[model samples]
Target: MPAEGARAGAATRGTQPAEGGPERPTRRFPRITRDTARPEGGGRAASGAAPAPARQWPLLVVLGTVALGLLLTSLDQFRPGTLLIGVALLAGAGLRWLLPGVGMLAVRSRFTDISTYGVLGLAIVLLAMMAQPNPWLQIPFLKDLLHVTLSNK
Candidate 1:
Protein backbone atom coordinates (compact mmCIF):
# COMPACT_ATOMS: atom_id res chain seq x y z
CA MET A 1 0.00 0.00 0.00
CA PRO A 2 2.84 2.44 0.82
CA ALA A 3 4.59 1.68 -2.49
CA GLU A 4 1.40 2.20 -4.46
CA GLY A 5 0.75 5.48 -2.70
CA ALA A 6 4.24 6.73 -3.44
CA ARG A 7 3.87 5.89 -7.12
CA ALA A 8 0.49 7.65 -7.34
CA GLY A 9 1.88 10.81 -5.66
CA ALA A 10 4.87 10.94 -8.00
CA ALA A 11 2.64 10.47 -11.04
CA THR A 12 0.29 13.22 -9.96
CA ARG A 13 3.17 15.66 -9.40
CA GLY A 14 4.90 14.54 -12.66
CA THR A 15 8.13 14.35 -10.63
CA GLN A 16 9.25 10.75 -11.18
CA PRO A 17 8.05 7.72 -13.14
CA ALA A 18 6.33 4.72 -11.52
CA GLU A 19 8.83 2.32 -9.94
CA GLY A 20 8.89 -0.20 -12.81
CA GLY A 21 8.15 2.02 -15.79
CA PRO A 22 10.41 4.05 -18.11
CA GLU A 23 11.20 7.63 -17.00
CA ARG A 24 9.03 10.36 -18.50
CA PRO A 25 9.72 14.03 -19.08
CA THR A 26 8.87 16.21 -16.06
CA ARG A 27 5.85 18.43 -16.63
CA ARG A 28 6.89 21.97 -15.68
CA PHE A 29 4.08 24.48 -15.11
CA PRO A 30 6.16 27.46 -16.27
CA ARG A 31 9.33 27.19 -18.32
CA ILE A 32 12.07 29.78 -17.91
CA THR A 33 14.68 30.82 -20.45
CA ARG A 34 17.72 33.08 -20.37
CA ASP A 35 17.40 36.58 -21.95
CA THR A 36 19.60 36.82 -25.01
CA ALA A 37 21.52 40.01 -25.88
CA ARG A 38 19.95 42.27 -28.50
CA PRO A 39 21.29 42.35 -32.06
CA GLU A 40 24.35 44.65 -32.56
CA GLY A 41 22.93 47.65 -34.48
CA GLY A 42 21.13 49.41 -31.59
CA GLY A 43 18.46 48.98 -28.92
CA ARG A 44 15.83 50.23 -31.37
CA ALA A 45 14.41 47.67 -33.77
CA ALA A 46 15.59 47.42 -37.39
CA SER A 47 12.23 48.75 -38.55
CA GLY A 48 11.95 52.56 -38.73
CA ALA A 49 11.21 53.83 -35.26
CA ALA A 50 7.78 55.34 -34.70
CA PRO A 51 7.59 59.03 -33.70
CA ALA A 52 8.38 59.52 -30.04
CA PRO A 53 5.39 61.78 -29.28
CA ALA A 54 1.79 61.29 -30.33
CA ARG A 55 0.17 63.85 -32.67
CA GLN A 56 -2.65 65.42 -30.64
CA TRP A 57 -3.07 68.95 -31.95
CA PRO A 58 -6.70 68.35 -32.82
CA LEU A 59 -7.47 67.21 -29.27
CA LEU A 60 -5.59 70.21 -27.92
CA VAL A 61 -7.65 72.54 -30.08
CA VAL A 62 -10.88 71.13 -28.72
CA LEU A 63 -9.68 71.40 -25.13
CA GLY A 64 -8.29 74.88 -25.57
CA THR A 65 -11.53 76.09 -27.13
CA VAL A 66 -13.53 74.73 -24.21
CA ALA A 67 -11.17 76.37 -21.74
CA LEU A 68 -11.55 79.69 -23.53
CA GLY A 69 -15.31 79.28 -23.51
CA LEU A 70 -15.27 78.68 -19.76
CA LEU A 71 -13.12 81.72 -19.20
CA LEU A 72 -15.50 83.84 -21.25
CA THR A 73 -18.50 82.61 -19.32
CA SER A 74 -16.72 83.42 -16.06
CA LEU A 75 -16.34 86.99 -17.37
CA ASP A 76 -20.16 87.40 -17.63
CA GLN A 77 -20.41 86.57 -21.37
CA PHE A 78 -22.84 83.69 -20.87
CA ARG A 79 -24.49 83.57 -24.30
CA PRO A 80 -21.34 83.83 -26.37
CA GLY A 81 -19.47 81.47 -24.09
CA THR A 82 -22.16 78.78 -24.38
CA LEU A 83 -22.09 79.14 -28.14
CA LEU A 84 -18.34 78.77 -28.10
CA ILE A 85 -18.55 75.62 -26.02
CA GLY A 86 -21.06 74.07 -28.39
CA VAL A 87 -18.94 74.97 -31.37
CA ALA A 88 -15.91 73.49 -29.66
CA LEU A 89 -17.66 70.15 -29.08
CA LEU A 90 -18.83 70.03 -32.69
CA ALA A 91 -15.33 70.80 -33.83
CA GLY A 92 -13.99 68.01 -31.66
CA ALA A 93 -16.41 65.62 -33.33
CA GLY A 94 -15.30 66.82 -36.72
CA LEU A 95 -11.66 66.47 -35.78
CA ARG A 96 -12.23 62.91 -34.60
CA TRP A 97 -14.13 62.07 -37.76
CA LEU A 98 -11.51 63.62 -40.01
CA LEU A 99 -8.48 62.36 -38.13
CA PRO A 100 -9.51 58.95 -36.84
CA GLY A 101 -5.91 57.93 -36.20
CA VAL A 102 -5.08 60.85 -33.93
CA GLY A 103 -3.80 59.51 -30.61
CA MET A 104 -5.67 59.95 -27.28
CA LEU A 105 -8.71 61.23 -29.16
CA ALA A 106 -9.64 57.66 -30.03
CA VAL A 107 -10.96 56.96 -26.54
CA ARG A 108 -14.08 55.23 -27.78
CA SER A 109 -15.19 53.54 -31.00
CA ARG A 110 -15.55 55.95 -33.92
CA PHE A 111 -19.36 55.91 -34.00
CA THR A 112 -19.58 56.46 -30.25
CA ASP A 113 -17.11 59.33 -30.38
CA ILE A 114 -18.99 61.15 -33.14
CA SER A 115 -22.45 60.70 -31.67
CA THR A 116 -21.41 61.78 -28.16
CA TYR A 117 -19.71 64.92 -29.40
CA GLY A 118 -22.49 65.82 -31.83
CA VAL A 119 -25.33 65.22 -29.40
CA LEU A 120 -23.72 67.15 -26.53
CA GLY A 121 -22.89 70.05 -28.82
CA LEU A 122 -26.38 70.17 -30.28
CA ALA A 123 -28.01 70.04 -26.86
CA ILE A 124 -25.83 72.83 -25.49
CA VAL A 125 -26.36 75.08 -28.50
CA LEU A 126 -30.12 74.52 -28.50
CA LEU A 127 -30.48 75.05 -24.78
CA ALA A 128 -28.41 78.19 -24.82
CA MET A 129 -30.47 79.69 -27.65
CA MET A 130 -33.76 78.82 -25.95
CA ALA A 131 -32.71 80.19 -22.54
CA GLN A 132 -32.17 83.77 -23.68
CA PRO A 133 -34.99 86.38 -23.13
CA ASN A 134 -34.87 86.81 -26.93
CA PRO A 135 -33.78 83.52 -28.45
CA TRP A 136 -31.35 83.87 -31.38
CA LEU A 137 -31.27 80.74 -33.58
CA GLN A 138 -34.85 79.57 -33.62
CA ILE A 139 -35.84 76.20 -35.12
CA PRO A 140 -39.63 75.74 -35.48
CA PHE A 141 -39.28 71.97 -35.43
CA LEU A 142 -37.20 72.09 -32.25
CA LYS A 143 -40.19 73.38 -30.30
CA ASP A 144 -42.41 70.51 -31.46
CA LEU A 145 -39.56 68.08 -30.88
CA LEU A 146 -39.04 69.27 -27.31
CA HIS A 147 -42.80 69.28 -26.71
CA VAL A 148 -43.16 65.67 -27.79
CA THR A 149 -40.03 64.67 -25.90
CA LEU A 150 -40.99 66.36 -22.63
CA SER A 151 -44.77 65.80 -22.77
CA ASN A 152 -44.40 62.11 -22.07
CA LYS A 153 -46.23 61.35 -18.78
Candidate 2:
Protein backbone atom coordinates (compact mmCIF):
# COMPACT_ATOMS: atom_id res chain seq x y z
CA MET A 1 0.00 0.00 0.00
CA PRO A 2 2.92 2.36 0.82
CA ALA A 3 4.61 1.49 -2.52
CA GLU A 4 1.33 2.16 -4.38
CA GLY A 5 0.99 5.56 -2.59
CA ALA A 6 4.62 6.46 -3.56
CA ARG A 7 4.00 5.48 -7.18
CA ALA A 8 0.77 7.52 -7.25
CA GLY A 9 2.58 10.63 -5.87
CA ALA A 10 5.41 10.24 -8.45
CA ALA A 11 2.88 9.83 -11.27
CA THR A 12 1.15 13.10 -10.32
CA ARG A 13 4.48 15.03 -10.02
CA GLY A 14 5.38 15.14 -13.74
CA THR A 15 3.28 17.02 -16.34
CA GLN A 16 0.46 14.78 -17.58
CA PRO A 17 0.43 14.19 -21.38
CA ALA A 18 -2.06 16.51 -23.13
CA GLU A 19 -4.79 15.06 -25.39
CA GLY A 20 -3.19 16.62 -28.54
CA GLY A 21 0.52 16.65 -29.58
CA PRO A 22 1.15 19.93 -27.68
CA GLU A 23 -0.81 21.83 -25.05
CA ARG A 24 -2.43 25.11 -26.08
CA PRO A 25 -0.58 28.15 -24.65
CA THR A 26 -2.65 30.20 -22.19
CA ARG A 27 -1.91 33.34 -20.11
CA ARG A 28 -3.12 33.56 -16.50
CA PHE A 29 -3.95 37.23 -17.06
CA PRO A 30 -5.01 37.12 -20.71
CA ARG A 31 -5.12 40.91 -21.14
CA ILE A 32 -1.46 41.48 -20.06
CA THR A 33 1.38 41.37 -22.64
CA ARG A 34 5.22 41.44 -22.49
CA ASP A 35 5.20 45.03 -23.87
CA THR A 36 4.74 47.03 -20.63
CA ALA A 37 6.19 50.26 -22.15
CA ARG A 38 3.64 53.06 -22.69
CA PRO A 39 3.16 53.94 -26.37
CA GLU A 40 3.96 57.43 -27.74
CA GLY A 41 1.35 60.13 -26.90
CA GLY A 42 0.80 61.59 -23.40
CA GLY A 43 -1.13 58.74 -21.74
CA ARG A 44 -3.82 59.04 -24.45
CA ALA A 45 -3.18 55.95 -26.55
CA ALA A 46 -5.50 54.90 -29.42
CA SER A 47 -7.40 52.46 -27.21
CA GLY A 48 -7.59 54.88 -24.25
CA ALA A 49 -8.89 57.86 -26.25
CA ALA A 50 -11.96 59.36 -24.60
CA PRO A 51 -15.16 59.69 -26.60
CA ALA A 52 -16.05 63.24 -27.77
CA PRO A 53 -18.61 65.02 -25.61
CA ALA A 54 -22.05 65.23 -27.27
CA ARG A 55 -23.25 68.69 -28.35
CA GLN A 56 -26.52 69.54 -26.53
CA TRP A 57 -27.22 73.10 -27.67
CA PRO A 58 -28.93 72.12 -30.93
CA LEU A 59 -31.21 69.63 -29.18
CA LEU A 60 -31.99 72.18 -26.45
CA VAL A 61 -32.91 74.77 -29.06
CA VAL A 62 -35.18 72.30 -30.87
CA LEU A 63 -36.90 71.33 -27.60
CA GLY A 64 -37.26 74.99 -26.56
CA THR A 65 -38.82 75.90 -29.93
CA VAL A 66 -41.24 72.96 -29.70
CA ALA A 67 -42.19 73.88 -26.10
CA LEU A 68 -42.74 77.57 -27.03
CA GLY A 69 -44.87 76.65 -30.01
CA LEU A 70 -46.89 74.19 -27.94
CA LEU A 71 -47.36 76.81 -25.19
CA LEU A 72 -48.54 79.42 -27.68
CA THR A 73 -50.99 76.98 -29.26
CA SER A 74 -52.21 75.74 -25.86
CA LEU A 75 -52.96 79.30 -24.58
CA ASP A 76 -56.24 79.33 -26.53
CA GLN A 77 -57.63 76.34 -24.44
CA PHE A 78 -60.12 75.57 -27.22
CA ARG A 79 -60.65 72.20 -29.02
CA PRO A 80 -58.12 73.17 -31.73
CA GLY A 81 -55.53 74.03 -29.08
CA THR A 82 -55.97 70.60 -27.47
CA LEU A 83 -55.54 68.96 -30.89
CA LEU A 84 -52.36 71.00 -31.49
CA ILE A 85 -50.94 69.80 -28.14
CA GLY A 86 -51.54 66.19 -29.18
CA VAL A 87 -49.87 66.85 -32.56
CA ALA A 88 -46.88 68.50 -30.86
CA LEU A 89 -46.47 65.50 -28.52
CA LEU A 90 -46.62 63.10 -31.48
CA ALA A 91 -44.02 65.14 -33.43
CA GLY A 92 -41.72 65.18 -30.39
CA ALA A 93 -42.04 61.38 -30.06
CA GLY A 94 -41.29 60.89 -33.77
CA LEU A 95 -38.24 63.16 -33.56
CA ARG A 96 -37.00 61.19 -30.55
CA TRP A 97 -37.27 57.92 -32.50
CA LEU A 98 -35.64 59.29 -35.64
CA LEU A 99 -32.68 60.98 -33.92
CA PRO A 100 -31.47 58.92 -30.98
CA GLY A 101 -28.09 59.91 -29.40
CA VAL A 102 -28.58 63.53 -30.51
CA GLY A 103 -26.79 65.66 -27.89
CA MET A 104 -27.45 64.91 -24.18
CA LEU A 105 -31.08 64.29 -25.06
CA ALA A 106 -30.42 60.53 -25.13
CA VAL A 107 -30.24 60.53 -21.31
CA ARG A 108 -33.82 61.84 -21.05
CA SER A 109 -34.88 59.31 -23.72
CA ARG A 110 -34.06 56.34 -21.50
CA PHE A 111 -37.38 56.96 -19.69
CA THR A 112 -39.38 57.71 -22.87
CA ASP A 113 -40.44 54.11 -23.52
CA ILE A 114 -41.26 53.55 -19.86
CA SER A 115 -43.14 56.89 -19.72
CA THR A 116 -45.29 55.87 -22.72
CA TYR A 117 -46.31 52.70 -20.90
CA GLY A 118 -46.79 54.69 -17.69
CA VAL A 119 -49.06 57.19 -19.48
CA LEU A 120 -51.11 54.33 -20.93
CA GLY A 121 -51.37 52.73 -17.47
CA LEU A 122 -52.44 56.07 -15.94
CA ALA A 123 -55.05 56.63 -18.66
CA ILE A 124 -56.46 53.14 -18.06
CA VAL A 125 -56.59 53.75 -14.30
CA LEU A 126 -58.27 57.14 -14.83
CA LEU A 127 -60.85 55.59 -17.15
CA ALA A 128 -61.55 52.80 -14.66
CA MET A 129 -61.88 55.33 -11.82
CA MET A 130 -64.24 57.46 -13.91
CA ALA A 131 -66.38 54.42 -14.76
CA GLN A 132 -66.84 53.76 -11.02
CA PRO A 133 -69.17 56.37 -9.49
CA ASN A 134 -67.07 56.57 -6.29
CA PRO A 135 -63.27 56.34 -6.40
CA TRP A 136 -61.84 54.86 -3.18
CA LEU A 137 -59.51 57.18 -1.31
CA GLN A 138 -58.11 55.26 1.66
CA ILE A 139 -58.08 57.04 5.03
CA PRO A 140 -54.85 57.15 7.03
CA PHE A 141 -56.21 54.60 9.56
CA LEU A 142 -57.28 52.17 6.80
CA LYS A 143 -53.91 52.49 5.08
CA ASP A 144 -52.06 51.81 8.36
CA LEU A 145 -54.27 48.78 9.11
CA LEU A 146 -53.70 47.36 5.61
CA HIS A 147 -49.92 47.86 5.95
CA VAL A 148 -49.91 46.12 9.36
CA THR A 149 -51.90 43.13 8.08
CA LEU A 150 -49.69 42.83 4.97
CA SER A 151 -46.50 43.04 7.10
CA ASN A 152 -47.77 40.37 9.49
CA LYS A 153 -48.56 38.01 6.57
Candidate 3:
Protein backbone atom coordinates (compact mmCIF):
# COMPACT_ATOMS: atom_id res chain seq x y z
CA MET A 1 0.00 0.00 0.00
CA PRO A 2 1.15 3.57 -0.66
CA ALA A 3 2.07 5.75 2.33
CA GLU A 4 -0.40 8.50 3.44
CA GLY A 5 2.05 11.22 2.43
CA ALA A 6 2.50 9.57 -0.96
CA ARG A 7 -1.27 9.44 -1.51
CA ALA A 8 -1.71 13.15 -0.60
CA GLY A 9 1.29 14.19 -2.66
CA ALA A 10 -0.02 12.37 -5.73
CA ALA A 11 -3.57 13.67 -5.24
CA THR A 12 -2.46 17.31 -4.98
CA ARG A 13 0.27 17.34 -7.62
CA GLY A 14 -0.98 20.38 -9.60
CA THR A 15 -2.65 22.21 -6.68
CA GLN A 16 0.03 21.88 -3.96
CA PRO A 17 2.55 24.66 -3.29
CA ALA A 18 6.13 24.11 -4.40
CA GLU A 19 7.56 23.43 -0.92
CA GLY A 20 6.53 26.69 0.87
CA GLY A 21 5.39 28.78 -2.09
CA PRO A 22 2.30 31.08 -1.84
CA GLU A 23 -1.02 29.28 -1.55
CA ARG A 24 -3.09 29.44 -4.72
CA PRO A 25 -6.88 29.33 -4.46
CA THR A 26 -8.75 26.82 -6.59
CA ARG A 27 -10.21 28.00 -9.90
CA ARG A 28 -13.72 26.99 -10.97
CA PHE A 29 -15.12 27.75 -14.44
CA PRO A 30 -12.37 30.38 -14.56
CA ARG A 31 -10.54 29.87 -17.82
CA ILE A 32 -10.51 33.63 -18.38
CA THR A 33 -8.44 35.75 -16.01
CA ARG A 34 -10.15 39.17 -16.20
CA ASP A 35 -13.85 38.92 -17.24
CA THR A 36 -16.28 37.29 -19.67
CA ALA A 37 -17.17 38.85 -23.00
CA ARG A 38 -20.61 40.37 -23.47
CA PRO A 39 -23.39 38.41 -25.18
CA GLU A 40 -24.20 38.85 -28.87
CA GLY A 41 -26.15 42.02 -29.80
CA GLY A 42 -25.07 43.55 -26.46
CA GLY A 43 -23.32 46.66 -27.73
CA ARG A 44 -24.57 50.22 -27.23
CA ALA A 45 -27.31 51.39 -29.61
CA ALA A 46 -25.29 54.54 -30.24
CA SER A 47 -21.51 55.03 -30.39
CA GLY A 48 -19.49 55.99 -27.32
CA ALA A 49 -19.49 59.66 -26.07
CA ALA A 50 -23.26 59.64 -26.34
CA PRO A 51 -25.19 60.01 -23.08
CA ALA A 52 -25.80 56.78 -21.17
CA PRO A 53 -29.53 56.92 -21.83
CA ALA A 54 -29.01 57.41 -25.56
CA ARG A 55 -26.55 54.57 -25.68
CA GLN A 56 -29.15 52.26 -24.16
CA TRP A 57 -32.16 53.47 -26.13
CA PRO A 58 -33.76 50.01 -26.60
CA LEU A 59 -33.97 49.32 -22.88
CA LEU A 60 -35.26 52.82 -22.18
CA VAL A 61 -38.01 52.62 -24.79
CA VAL A 62 -39.36 49.40 -23.30
CA LEU A 63 -39.09 50.77 -19.78
CA GLY A 64 -40.84 54.03 -20.73
CA THR A 65 -43.68 52.13 -22.37
CA VAL A 66 -44.13 49.98 -19.27
CA ALA A 67 -44.12 53.05 -17.06
CA LEU A 68 -46.84 54.60 -19.16
CA GLY A 69 -48.81 51.36 -18.96
CA LEU A 70 -48.54 51.42 -15.18
CA LEU A 71 -49.69 55.04 -15.13
CA LEU A 72 -52.79 54.08 -17.10
CA THR A 73 -53.45 51.17 -14.71
CA SER A 74 -53.18 53.55 -11.73
CA LEU A 75 -55.91 55.65 -13.34
CA ASP A 76 -58.23 52.54 -13.43
CA GLN A 77 -57.75 51.76 -17.12
CA PHE A 78 -56.65 48.21 -16.46
CA ARG A 79 -57.16 46.19 -19.65
CA PRO A 80 -55.60 48.54 -22.18
CA GLY A 81 -52.80 49.38 -19.75
CA THR A 82 -52.02 45.71 -19.29
CA LEU A 83 -52.12 45.21 -23.06
CA LEU A 84 -49.64 48.01 -23.48
CA ILE A 85 -47.37 46.50 -20.87
CA GLY A 86 -47.46 43.14 -22.64
CA VAL A 87 -46.83 44.81 -25.97
CA ALA A 88 -43.78 46.55 -24.52
CA LEU A 89 -42.36 43.24 -23.45
CA LEU A 90 -43.14 41.82 -26.88
CA ALA A 91 -41.38 44.76 -28.45
CA GLY A 92 -38.39 44.15 -26.22
CA ALA A 93 -38.27 40.57 -27.50
CA GLY A 94 -38.43 41.82 -31.07
CA LEU A 95 -35.65 44.32 -30.44
CA ARG A 96 -33.48 41.65 -28.86
CA TRP A 97 -34.03 39.38 -31.84
CA LEU A 98 -33.66 41.93 -34.61
CA LEU A 99 -31.19 44.54 -33.36
CA PRO A 100 -27.45 43.98 -33.26
CA GLY A 101 -26.75 46.71 -30.69
CA VAL A 102 -29.40 46.38 -28.02
CA GLY A 103 -27.04 47.37 -25.19
CA MET A 104 -28.39 46.58 -21.72
CA LEU A 105 -31.54 45.19 -23.27
CA ALA A 106 -29.64 42.00 -24.10
CA VAL A 107 -29.89 40.38 -20.70
CA ARG A 108 -28.35 36.99 -21.51
CA SER A 109 -27.56 34.92 -24.59
CA ARG A 110 -29.65 35.75 -27.65
CA PHE A 111 -31.79 32.60 -27.52
CA THR A 112 -32.42 32.80 -23.78
CA ASP A 113 -33.30 36.48 -23.84
CA ILE A 114 -35.62 36.07 -26.78
CA SER A 115 -37.35 33.05 -25.27
CA THR A 116 -37.79 34.64 -21.86
CA TYR A 117 -39.16 37.92 -23.20
CA GLY A 118 -41.47 36.21 -25.69
CA VAL A 119 -42.94 33.83 -23.13
CA LEU A 120 -43.46 36.46 -20.45
CA GLY A 121 -44.96 38.91 -22.95
CA LEU A 122 -47.35 36.29 -24.34
CA ALA A 123 -48.34 35.14 -20.83
CA ILE A 124 -49.04 38.72 -19.70
CA VAL A 125 -51.09 39.45 -22.82
CA LEU A 126 -53.10 36.27 -22.45
CA LEU A 127 -53.78 36.85 -18.77
CA ALA A 128 -54.79 40.45 -19.44
CA MET A 129 -57.17 39.31 -22.16
CA MET A 130 -58.74 36.83 -19.74
CA ALA A 131 -59.04 38.94 -16.59
CA GLN A 132 -62.31 38.72 -14.56
CA PRO A 133 -65.96 39.61 -15.37
CA ASN A 134 -66.50 39.13 -19.13
CA PRO A 135 -63.04 38.08 -20.18
CA TRP A 136 -62.21 38.70 -23.84
CA LEU A 137 -60.97 35.14 -24.34
CA GLN A 138 -61.57 31.79 -22.64
CA ILE A 139 -60.26 28.24 -22.60
CA PRO A 140 -63.16 25.86 -21.94
CA PHE A 141 -61.11 23.15 -20.20
CA LEU A 142 -59.33 25.56 -17.82
CA LYS A 143 -62.44 26.03 -15.67
CA ASP A 144 -62.93 22.26 -15.31
CA LEU A 145 -59.18 21.73 -14.74
CA LEU A 146 -59.07 24.33 -12.00
CA HIS A 147 -62.16 22.87 -10.34
CA VAL A 148 -60.71 19.36 -10.48
CA THR A 149 -57.36 20.37 -9.02
CA LEU A 150 -58.78 22.57 -6.26
CA SER A 151 -61.56 20.22 -5.17
CA ASN A 152 -61.02 18.34 -1.88
CA LYS A 153 -62.83 15.31 -3.28
Candidate 4:
Protein backbone atom coordinates (compact mmCIF):
# COMPACT_ATOMS: atom_id res chain seq x y z
CA MET A 1 0.00 0.00 0.00
CA PRO A 2 1.24 3.54 -0.92
CA ALA A 3 1.66 6.31 1.72
CA GLU A 4 -1.08 9.06 1.82
CA GLY A 5 1.29 11.78 0.49
CA ALA A 6 2.46 9.42 -2.33
CA ARG A 7 -1.21 8.71 -3.22
CA ALA A 8 -1.94 12.45 -3.31
CA GLY A 9 1.06 13.02 -5.56
CA ALA A 10 -0.13 10.29 -7.92
CA ALA A 11 -3.59 11.84 -8.10
CA THR A 12 -2.19 15.34 -8.91
CA ARG A 13 0.65 14.19 -11.13
CA GLY A 14 -0.96 14.62 -14.57
CA THR A 15 -2.80 17.86 -13.48
CA GLN A 16 0.24 19.49 -11.79
CA PRO A 17 1.87 22.74 -12.94
CA ALA A 18 5.13 22.19 -14.86
CA GLU A 19 8.28 23.42 -13.15
CA GLY A 20 8.84 27.15 -13.89
CA GLY A 21 5.49 27.21 -15.96
CA PRO A 22 1.89 28.42 -15.42
CA GLU A 23 -1.07 25.95 -14.95
CA ARG A 24 -3.50 25.36 -17.85
CA PRO A 25 -7.10 26.62 -17.66
CA THR A 26 -10.01 24.05 -17.57
CA ARG A 27 -13.34 24.60 -19.49
CA ARG A 28 -16.92 24.08 -18.23
CA PHE A 29 -18.56 23.53 -21.67
CA PRO A 30 -15.82 22.59 -24.08
CA ARG A 31 -18.36 22.02 -26.91
CA ILE A 32 -19.48 25.68 -26.88
CA THR A 33 -16.29 27.70 -27.04
CA ARG A 34 -17.98 30.93 -28.28
CA ASP A 35 -21.53 32.29 -28.98
CA THR A 36 -20.67 32.00 -32.69
CA ALA A 37 -20.77 28.22 -32.22
CA ARG A 38 -24.58 28.53 -32.51
CA PRO A 39 -26.01 28.40 -36.02
CA GLU A 40 -27.65 31.47 -37.67
CA GLY A 41 -31.06 30.16 -36.64
CA GLY A 42 -31.01 29.79 -32.89
CA GLY A 43 -33.36 27.56 -30.88
CA ARG A 44 -33.44 24.09 -29.46
CA ALA A 45 -30.77 21.69 -30.70
CA ALA A 46 -31.48 19.38 -33.68
CA SER A 47 -31.72 16.20 -31.59
CA GLY A 48 -35.34 16.14 -30.31
CA ALA A 49 -37.71 18.89 -31.50
CA ALA A 50 -41.42 18.46 -32.36
CA PRO A 51 -42.76 19.00 -35.91
CA ALA A 52 -45.24 21.79 -36.81
CA PRO A 53 -48.99 21.15 -37.40
CA ALA A 54 -50.51 21.51 -40.89
CA ARG A 55 -53.17 24.06 -41.95
CA GLN A 56 -56.76 22.91 -42.87
CA TRP A 57 -58.77 26.01 -43.83
CA PRO A 58 -60.42 24.28 -46.80
CA LEU A 59 -61.82 21.49 -44.67
CA LEU A 60 -63.10 23.95 -42.08
CA VAL A 61 -64.93 26.14 -44.61
CA VAL A 62 -66.53 23.19 -46.41
CA LEU A 63 -67.83 21.72 -43.18
CA GLY A 64 -69.13 25.08 -41.96
CA THR A 65 -70.93 25.78 -45.25
CA VAL A 66 -72.54 22.36 -45.26
CA ALA A 67 -73.80 22.87 -41.72
CA LEU A 68 -75.26 26.25 -42.63
CA GLY A 69 -77.00 24.78 -45.69
CA LEU A 70 -78.46 21.93 -43.68
CA LEU A 71 -79.83 24.33 -41.07
CA LEU A 72 -81.43 26.55 -43.74
CA THR A 73 -83.09 23.58 -45.45
CA SER A 74 -84.69 22.39 -42.21
CA LEU A 75 -86.66 25.60 -41.65
CA ASP A 76 -90.53 25.53 -42.20
CA GLN A 77 -92.10 27.19 -45.27
CA PHE A 78 -89.98 28.17 -48.31
CA ARG A 79 -88.25 24.81 -48.28
CA PRO A 80 -87.43 24.92 -52.02
CA GLY A 81 -86.26 28.52 -51.87
CA THR A 82 -84.22 27.80 -48.75
CA LEU A 83 -82.70 24.85 -50.56
CA LEU A 84 -81.86 27.07 -53.55
CA ILE A 85 -80.19 29.64 -51.32
CA GLY A 86 -78.32 26.86 -49.53
CA VAL A 87 -77.16 25.48 -52.84
CA ALA A 88 -75.92 28.91 -53.98
CA LEU A 89 -74.18 29.59 -50.68
CA LEU A 90 -72.58 26.15 -50.72
CA ALA A 91 -71.46 26.56 -54.35
CA GLY A 92 -69.84 29.88 -53.54
CA ALA A 93 -68.19 28.47 -50.46
CA GLY A 94 -67.01 25.48 -52.43
CA LEU A 95 -65.50 27.75 -55.07
CA ARG A 96 -63.75 29.70 -52.38
CA TRP A 97 -62.34 26.53 -50.87
CA LEU A 98 -61.28 24.93 -54.14
CA LEU A 99 -59.78 28.08 -55.66
CA PRO A 100 -58.17 30.28 -53.04
CA GLY A 101 -56.71 32.76 -55.50
CA VAL A 102 -60.19 33.48 -56.89
CA GLY A 103 -61.58 33.36 -53.37
CA MET A 104 -59.37 36.33 -52.56
CA LEU A 105 -62.17 38.48 -53.96
CA ALA A 106 -64.56 36.98 -51.40
CA VAL A 107 -62.06 37.65 -48.60
CA ARG A 108 -60.61 41.02 -49.60
CA SER A 109 -63.33 42.92 -51.44
CA ARG A 110 -66.43 44.47 -49.83
CA PHE A 111 -68.25 44.48 -53.19
CA THR A 112 -67.97 40.72 -53.59
CA ASP A 113 -69.03 40.14 -50.01
CA ILE A 114 -72.05 42.41 -50.41
CA SER A 115 -72.95 40.70 -53.68
CA THR A 116 -72.90 37.32 -51.97
CA TYR A 117 -75.09 38.64 -49.19
CA GLY A 118 -77.39 40.20 -51.77
CA VAL A 119 -77.82 36.85 -53.47
CA LEU A 120 -78.81 35.37 -50.11
CA GLY A 121 -81.25 38.24 -49.57
CA LEU A 122 -82.72 37.67 -53.01
CA ALA A 123 -83.20 34.03 -52.15
CA ILE A 124 -85.22 35.06 -49.09
CA VAL A 125 -87.31 37.45 -51.24
CA LEU A 126 -87.98 34.64 -53.71
CA LEU A 127 -89.05 32.49 -50.79
CA ALA A 128 -91.62 35.13 -49.88
CA MET A 129 -92.76 35.23 -53.49
CA MET A 130 -93.18 31.47 -53.48
CA ALA A 131 -95.41 31.71 -50.37
CA GLN A 132 -97.87 34.02 -52.27
CA PRO A 133 -100.20 32.85 -55.04
CA ASN A 134 -99.14 33.80 -58.61
CA PRO A 135 -100.74 37.10 -59.76
CA TRP A 136 -102.67 36.98 -63.09
CA LEU A 137 -101.57 39.40 -65.84
CA GLN A 138 -103.49 42.71 -65.58
CA ILE A 139 -103.09 43.83 -69.23
CA PRO A 140 -103.30 40.43 -70.97
CA PHE A 141 -101.87 42.17 -74.08
CA LEU A 142 -99.48 39.37 -75.08
CA LYS A 143 -102.22 36.72 -74.86
CA ASP A 144 -104.61 38.86 -76.94
CA LEU A 145 -101.91 39.48 -79.59
CA LEU A 146 -101.22 35.74 -79.82
CA HIS A 147 -104.94 35.01 -80.21
CA VAL A 148 -105.34 37.62 -82.99
CA THR A 149 -102.29 36.30 -84.87
CA LEU A 150 -103.53 32.69 -84.70
CA SER A 151 -107.10 33.66 -85.91
CA ASN A 152 -105.63 35.64 -88.86
CA LYS A 153 -103.67 32.51 -89.96
| Candidate topping lDDT | 3
Kindly report which residue stretches of model 1 are placed more than 4 angstroms away from their true locations once superposed: 1-54, 139-153
**TM-score between candidate 4 and the true structure:** 0.24
TM-score of every prediction relative to native: 0.56, 0.29, 0.78, 0.24
**Candidate 4 regions off by >4 Å?**
1-68, 71-105, 128-153
Order by lDDT, highest first: 3, 1, 4, 2
lDDT of candidate 3 over 92-114, digit per residue (tens) = 99999999889999978999999
Clashing pairs in 1: none
Q: What is the lDDT of residue 8 in candidate 2?
A: 53
- Give the TM-score (vs. native) of candidate 1: 0.56
Report lDDT (CA) for all predictions. 0.73, 0.44, 0.88, 0.47
Scored by Cα lDDT, where does model 4 land?
A: 0.47
RMSD of each: 10.5, 14.9, 5.5, 24.2
Q: Candidate 2's residue-wise lDDT over 1-153, tens digit each?
A: 997677555444433334344443443343446865432221211122434432454345446654665676568533333344444444444444555444433334335633563455354434333332354332468558868989946
